[model samples]
Target: MAVHHQASIVPTKAELLAAWVPRQPWAAGADTSSLTKLGSYRFDDPDGEVGMETHVLATADGQVLQVPLTYRGAPRAGAEESLVTTMTHTTLGDRWIYDALHDPVYAAVLASTIATGGHEADLFLSTPDGLVLQPASARVRGSGTAPSAPAAGWSGPRVTVAGTTSRIECDGALLTVLHVLETTTASAAADELVLTGTWLGQDRPVLLAVLR
Candidate 1:
């Protein structure tokens, strides 16, 4: 038998968020064009080749936002529009930065990490090639339909509630909520969560939630 191996590259906490925050649509003060990082942490990826980073940034106007960034070797095919921004890592040298949400492989890794404690429901989207589902560990209290198939060109996963629908996507270490019908009603609550891993240079716990 033969074994294959690959090199791993990880970025520092500052480097991770510095490359991440400005790209987010929800990022406040983004339009002003100046950014200052307040704090940051990392999410665990057992395979170090992929790096997940969470950052707290302060805008010139004093608004703060949490941004998560995932670093990958290459860009996902056909997702150039979803690509947020690209920058070089100081420690890693010349590798390119990629947004994880657009990449199915990284999404699977994130979903698997989240699905550890609870049972994974089968409400995922399917393609002729395979199925892509968001990993949910909470108990489904009521009956609801699964999400619709992923859309083409900058479309994200569909999550429905009552008669309304929303789109969910992950970017790097941060999860993005879009097309929300009602903002007040959309939220995430977890019983208990832990920060058991680290990415970039910060520590990350499993209970992290991105609420709209």
Candidate 2:
């Protein structure tokens, strides 16, 4: 059977940082301030539909910060209001926006992409709750299948950490790292991946790892 790859559409590094920096919690400028783009690079998302871009920006203050962004179809359901300034409405009405700290999908893809080709990296798992983690193993399965939906349950490999099974989920620019702590624990219990770097939204060199 032939495998179909989803199309990935991402803004250029310059475009991404131009749009991203202002939305960060630590952004220096006022809402009306202008930003200069420094550089950017792409991270691997198994499913091409969801594109992940890391952007670096230099503010008017001369301070640089890295901001990681996940571009998706449109504003998330209840996030419409938060979309006010963060979203850049597309022709398709597919709003490109900033989902800062807790976006699960982006984190998952970033982790998987970074883990690829690295020794001692086992499996990249995304749980239904949106957690992405690399389990220690010699051979991992489904590394080729990038997650497309948040609700799709875990279907690849069997990883038992501390007697808990885990999965990783990546949606657009968010990555979810999940650990199935116990049957009683909520299915969605997981940690978030936040982007921190020299320049706002820049993930080059080393994607500064911050556990949120």
Candidate 3:
């Protein structure tokens, strides 16, 4: 389970996105002015050194995009160019945020979630009343089980299909994430499609990634 805080984050997620997203090739024609969040999901790092989250966003004209992000205590080594920005969390101190593909924590959790047929973790709150369940954000489901999450120290083997870049670990199985997902143009070819969930007012099962 994940514990969320009511603390504020400096610069805010939207501010950072507005500055960095337009430059990405996949977001080339997005209408930033009217961008709306469709929903989001999260993954937990067993070691607890990082935070992993994927937000589904929608453009004014009806384009859906999947953006995965990783939060860390320090800047990712050798990945300066991918840094989205640095922010101070009211409760967690300063944090370094990066596009998920450049962070190993994201790679590991994503691979494991799909391989083990996992789902977005439940959320809870710690208070005087003890642990209380929080309202779920988005609902998601994963499939298959083989390309287990690599060991903690493993960085990643990032890949790109079509125009989307992904972080994957394909040993005995395949677990890959299409960083900038364009559902309208995604190819329906894969060993097994995994990870589907619900969005606000939408119940269609969207394929998050391809697993084999």
Which ten contiguous residues of candidate 2 have the minimum total lDDT? 178-187
Model 2 per-residue lDDT tens digits across residues 62-155: 5544445556565555444323233334332344554433344554544554233221122234445553554221111122233342342233
Candidate 3 structure quality by residue, lDDT tens digits, 55-150: 888777777778888889988788887799999999889999998866766766776776677889777776666788887768777765655643
Over 12-118, each residue of candidate 1 has an lDDT whose tens digit, in order, gives: 44555555555454453243255556444444454556555444455656544444456665665676755555555444454545554455544444344343432
CA RMSD, predictions in order: 12.6, 14.4, 3.1
Mark the regions of model 3 whose C-alpha exceeds 4 Å error after superposition.
Answer: 126-130, 145-154, 159-161, 164-175, 179-190
Candidate No. with top lDDT? 3
lDDT-best of 2 and 3: 3
Cα-lDDT of candidate 3 = 0.71
TM-score for all models, in order of appearance: 0.45, 0.42, 0.83
Of the candidates shown, which would achieve the greatest TM-score relative to the real structure? 3
Candidate 1 vs candidate 2: the TM-score winner is 1
User: Clash number for every model?
Assistant: 8, 39, 1
After TM-score superposition, the amount by which residue 62's alpha carbon in candidate 2 deviates from its true location, in angstroms, is 2.2
**Candidates ranked by TM-score, best first?**
3, 1, 2
User: How high is the lDDT of residue 52 in model 2?
Assistant: 48
